[model samples]
Every structure is written in C-alpha cells, then in structure tokens.
Target: MDKRRVVVTGVGAVTPLGNDAETTWNNLITGVSGIGPLTRVNADDFPAKVAAEVKEFDPTDFMEKKDARKMDRFAQFAVAASIMAVKDSGLDINEENSEQVGVWIGSGIGGMETFENQYQNFLNKGYRRVSPFFVPMLIPDMAAGQVSITLGARGVNSCTVTACATGTNSIGDAFKVIQRGDALAMVTGGAEAPITNMSVAGFCANTALSTNPDPKTACRPFDADRDGFILGEGAGIVVLEELEHALARGAHIYAEIVGYGSTGDAYHITAPAPGGEGGARAMKMAINDGGLKPEEIDYINAHGTSTAYNDKFETAAIKEIFADHATRLAISSTKSMTGHLLGAAGGIEAIISVLSIKEGIIPPTINYVTSDPECDLDYVPNEARKQDVTAAMSNSLGFGGHNATIVFKKYN
Candidate 1:
C-alpha cells in the first residue's frame, strides 16, 4: 500500500525568545540570545546562574481564568500553542470533523511545580488537602489530554515520553498515524515548563547545567570553551495534515515531512553512546527513509546541546553518517541562543527547520567565538546566512540515549 504524504500546515511556538513562531523566528535569525539571569529560582543556591525562560505569557489570553488554573504551566503552554496552531491552519475542529483530528503532545517532566506543591500539601495537611486536579495536572500526558479536550478532538490522543526526545518522537509518531490513515489531521508538538526548583536542583546535582555566570555565553554550542547546556522552557506546536485533506481545505503548507528515524544508545542513562553511534544510525535511517542521499541535504538543524560530550559526539556522528557531505552542509544549532528546551527542543527545532525550507535561510549558532577541533563543520556561526535550502534535517538526542531525526523538504 502506498503511504499518504504528510505536510505541516501551521506552526506555533512559545519560546525563550518569543511567544509566537514569527516573533521567535525573527529573534532567531537576528542572532538574539534569550538566556538571562536565572530568576525563577534563586541563583545563589545553585552553580548554574542562567536560563532561557519564556517571557510575558498570559494564559488568560488563550483560556478562561478558571480553565487556565486547572492546568499546569506546561499544559497551559500546550493548549495555548495548539490553539494558535489550529487557528493558523484555518482548520475547524467542528462536531463534523472533530473526531478525525487527533492530538499528540509530550513533555520531559510534567509539572514539577505541581508535584512539589501538592506533595508538600499532602505531607503537611494530608491527602484531603491536595487539590482534586492534582493527578491530572501533574501527569506528563496532561499536555496531550488538555489539548484534545480544548480542541474537542476524539480520534487518537496520545503522548510520547522519551525524555528529551519526547517532542520530536511524538510528532514523528503522529506523522506515521496520518501516513497509515489513522487520522486526517493531527495537532502535534512538545511542551515544557522545567524552570522549577526540583528540575533545577536535579540538573544541577547531575552537573549537566552550565556554571557560567553570564547569560549571553552560557550556551555556546560547539565552542571550545563550552561547558554544558543551559536549561530552558517553552512549547512548540504544529498542525500536520494529510496532503489531500490539506489541499482540499486549501491550507498553506509550510513543508513536507518525508522521513523519521529514531534509535536508542543503550549505553548510558545520561550520556550519548561512544562517538554517537546511535545518533549516526538514526541520521542515516532518516536519509534512507526519505529516499535521499546525504549530498542532497542542504542543511542540518543539529542537536548540539552545548555539553562537552554531546557537541563532540554529535559532530562525530554527523561526519560518520554524511562523510564528506558533512563538510559541505550548512549546519547550526539554534540552541546556542534558545538554550536547551529538553523535551520541547525537538518541536521548536523542527519548526526552525521547516521555516528554513519555507524562507530559504538558515539560523545560526551564535556565540561561536572559538571552534573546537572535534567539531569541524560549517556551523553557520554567529550570523544568519541566505541559502536556498531545498531539504533540511532536524535532530533531537535525549538523555536516555533516545535519538530521533526527521527530514523536511520544501513543499513543491
């Protein structure tokens, strides 16, 4: 049986840079850094003093005050972004077609603040003191559930939880659902609000966060002086539609998602495999799945997390998979400015890749003042470049050795 093609019709993002896709993309191409002094938590308590935090977001703008309070911050973001995405697609989730529109959203850690607060309430006051919405608000699947409820979609509602690979994996899964004729249209993406006390303490305890005091230089991916990734929070949502359905609705297609690849390192819990072997295979698989050669890929939105091992090993993986073509590819990590969104990284990076195809330009890896010998690629450093990008790849590598890659092409 022939597979149905999947196309991205609308995208929405609430990032450290901005609250909407257009705002974030504008800041991204202009080489802006969203990292700032860690304000959500007391910086004096931890070694890491900086983070990329979403700014000026008001849930009441998207949802009713009562409805907003029932959701955790992550769920609020997912619902808000999905609302924007669906609106952008101009696809109505009416009673007639609502059942055909599904929702798949994911998160790394679902409501750390909710868990912490409710746990304290339980410990101090007892189980009766906990809010009735505790379980629903604290679960990672709430993002998907809330989105489905908000949009009134009923066909397939699921969430993928693969650590940092959650967002990309979820989107890829939704794409397969459409390709397999499970649904006509899908609301898919990832969301996170990880700037909580427990999350910070956890990453700090693991020493996976940058200790840099300066916000601008905290997340310098592939740079020689890079230390580790900076924590960030945000959500990215996209409306994916089957080619015929989208065309029948005359929706504006951003790009076509042609291939998806995922793999597990099976080596360590918090580290990538030696030389990123798993990641390399995933990249190769995506290219093969797309029926394209490495030489045909114009650009790569790298999973360069700015960590010592991640940047080095990911660079090695790219070279191994693409060979000489890696040198010719215009590769860059937008995480250099956005910091690491963890689970949400895949969604936003996927959007960046799609926008690059639509606009024929590539965002840059800012703060690349010095290069590392191990990471020898054209990392489109510091400044955005004008390039006619026909095909692009977006990669996401999670802590559990989960590696996912998706290939996107200009909608011709």
Candidate 2:
C-alpha cells in the first residue's frame, strides 16, 4: 500500500511565553524572554536561580475542576493543550469517527511534584496517606493517556519518552500512524511539569543547568559566553490530519509533515556523540525521507540547548549535513526565549517551524551575542527575520542519545 500524506491542521501550547500557541509564537517572533526567577521551588536552595515557568495557568480553564484534581500538573498541561488543539482543528470525535482519531503525547519527566508530595506523605504519615491517583499521576505515559481519555480519542493512544526528544518523537510516530492509514487524525505533541525540587536538583547536580541569576540573558544559545540550559516546563500539542481527510472537512492546513527521521547516538548517555555524528545522520535521513535536496530546507528550529557541547556539536552536525548550504540556512533556537521545555521543546518548536512556513517569518534565537568560532552559522539572532520559508525542519536531541528530526513544508 502507498503511504498517505499528512498535514498539520492545528496547534496549541502552554509555555513559559504564553498559555496558547499564537501567543507563544508572537512572543517568540518578537524576541521576548520568558525566563524569570525560579519561584516554583525556592531559588536560593539551588544553583539554578531562573526558569521558564507557565504563569497564571488555571487548569479549570481547560478541564473540569473534578477531573483536573485527579491529574498532575503535567497531565493538566497535556489536557489543556489537547483541548485547545482539538478545538482548533475542528475534528469532532463522534461514535462513528472516534476510532479513527488517536493521541500520542509524551513527557521527559512526569509529575515530579506529585511524586515528591506523595513520597513525603508516605514517609511522614503512612501508606494510606498516598492518594490512589499517585501511581497514575507519576508515570510518564499518563499525559498521553489522560489526553486520550479527555478527548475521547480511541485509536492508538500512546506516548514516547526520549528525554528532550519526547515531543518530536511522539509527533513523528503519530505522523507515521496516519501515513500508514491506521488513523485519520492524531492529537500529538509533548508536555512536562518538571519545575519541582527534585528535577531542579538533579539537573543542578549534573551541572546541566545554567547558574546565571539573570533570567533575561541566561539561555544564550550558540553564544560564546553561554553557560548551560535554563530549566523550563509546559506543553505543546498539534492536530495532524491526513491530507484527504483534512481537505474533505475544509480544515485549515498549517503545513505538510513530509518526513520524519529518528536515530540514536549509542555513544553516550548524557552527552551527544563526538562531532554530532548521530545528529548529522538524522538530518540526512529526514531530508532523504522527504525526497528533498539539502538546499531546499529554508529554516531550522535547532535543538540549541545553550549547553557548551550541544551548541557546538549541533553546529557541526548542520555543517556536516548541509555543507555549503548550511551557511545559507537560517537556523535559530527558540529555546533562547522559551528556555528548555525538556520533552515539550520539540512540540512547541514543531509548531514554530510550521508557523514559519505558513507566515513566511522565521523566529529568532534571542539573547545571542558574542558568536563562537565553532558555531558560525547564520542564527537569525536577537530579532525575527521576514523570509519566504518554503520548508522548515525542527531538530530535537535528547539525553539518552536520542535524535529526532521532522520536516514541514508549506502547503500548496
């Protein structure tokens, strides 16, 4: 059987920049920094003093009060974003079509706050003090599960947990599901609420997070003075529909998801492979999967985590894959503004990539200054660029050597 074409119809997000997709994209293009003083957990207790946290979010806005209570913050984010995405897509899930709809949301870390609270309760009180919802809330797959339950999507409910690449991998898998004719539409992306004490301490212990106190200038990806990534939390969700299915309903198509590539470094656990060999392969595979030449890609939403190795190695990977065309590609990391949304990074970044093709504007890598010799690509720095982006690619590299890339093309 031939593979069906897939297109992104709708997108939604709850991020440090805003509560919805458009707001986040606006902030991203305007070069706004969403990082602020870490308040979710006491800042003084940890070396990382700043974070990109979702502010003024009330779960009741998206779900019922009773249902929201049963879910952790991460699940709440997933449900909120999913509800928004489904509404945006106008894909009604009735009894006849419910089985044709699916959900695949992922998280790098799920319910860290819930785990900490439940463990403290167990230690202080007894086993009975633990809530029955603890187990469901603590697991990483619960975000996908809860979104499916809330949205009444009965087909292919699943999750992918590849650290920071969770969002991209989940979306890629969902694209495959639709291409294979298993589902007509899928609500897929990633979510995380990892601002809890344990998550902060773990990253700090590994020296993976920036110790910079000023939130405005902390996450400066590809900059010479960059320290490390800023911890962040939020969710990003998108509604992907088969081309004929979407056209039949007259749904607004954002961009066509033409290719997906996933690879593993297998060289390290926390560090990327030497010279980003795995990343270069993933990019090559994605371009080949799309049957496009390297020069056809107009923009790249890079997984520039601002960490020393990540920025340098990702630059190397781009050069290795694109060669002369690398210099012409307008690569930018929205992580500079949104911080590192961990697993949800790819989800929001994918949304941004689609928007870039649709709007003909590339979002900038804000906070970039003092360029590094190792990273000498044209990072649309500090300000958004107006360009006719025909095709865009988003890259996500996770801690466990997981590398995923998804390509989006302007729908004709």
lDDT of 1 by residue, 68-181 (tens): 889999999899889999999999899999888999899999988799999999999999999999999999999999999889999799999888888889899999999999
Q: What's each prediction's TM-score? A: 0.99, 0.99
lDDT of 2 by residue, 139-228 (tens): 989999998888888999999999999999999999999999999999999999999999999999999999999998999999999999
What is the Å distance of residue 32 in model 2 from its true position? Answer: 0.8
Flag clash pairs in model 1.
Answer: none
What lDDT does model 1 reach? 0.93
RMSD of 2: 0.6
* lDDT of the structure predicted as candidate 2: 0.94
Where does candidate 1 stray beyond 4 Å?
A: none
Q: Ten consecutive residues with minimal summed lDDT in candidate 1?
A: 161-170
